[model samples]
Target: MWGEMLGAAIGGVVAVAAAPVVLSAVGFTGSGIAAASIAAKMMSAAAVANGGGVAAGSLVATLQSIGVLGLSTSTNIILGSVGAAIGAAGASEVS
Candidate 1:
């Protein structure tokens, strides 16, 4: 529905807007490193989630250890949710 589209748009905007702030706050100067780390962590979480275990905590820990100090608990949940939604949509489209 239109509401979902609006929500997704807002979420995308928030994620885009927050990315730089997060990277700078976490002391990551390289986009490549940030992108790689995030992708790896998200993939790890996906694996864990598929195995019937929640990986959000592990993902958060990994991000925190990598200096993502500005990434709050809510941010982790939002990011994870977004990642999951994207994956599901892609899978459905491919199927």
Candidate 2:
């Protein structure tokens, strides 16, 4: 019970503290992600305009081509797991 809380606290702190160093070492940045997403959206818009077809599938495929869809899915999964962990830790304390 308490152990889980301690584990969550320590793990959260360590992950937060290490994330910047890890991200920087790997040359990942929020700005880069945002720029890529904007580029992908623009590309999708251009493709739709050129194709003269407003099919949603075409836009999805265009975004997927730029890895936008895949990255977003993976990010959601990772964040969901972290949220679940944090939520569980809190629940344990209440119970």
Leading candidate by lDDT? 1
Could you tell me the lDDT of residue 36 within candidate 1?
A: 49
Question: Looking at model 1, how many pairs of residues clash?
Answer: 0
If scored against the real structure, what TM-score would every candidate get? 0.32, 0.32
lDDT for each residue of candidate 1 in 1-95, tens digit (9 for 90 to 100): 44455555656556646665676554443333344465455555666776944365665445544443445667766775685466555545555
lDDT of 2 at 70: 30
Model 2: per-residue Cα lDDT over 1-95, one tens digit each: 76666656655555444544444333333433233455445545766687853455554343333343233555545645575578557757767
Clashing pairs in 2: none
What is candidate 2's TM-score against the reference?
A: 0.32
* C-alpha RMSD in Å of predicted model 2 compared with the true structure: 10.1
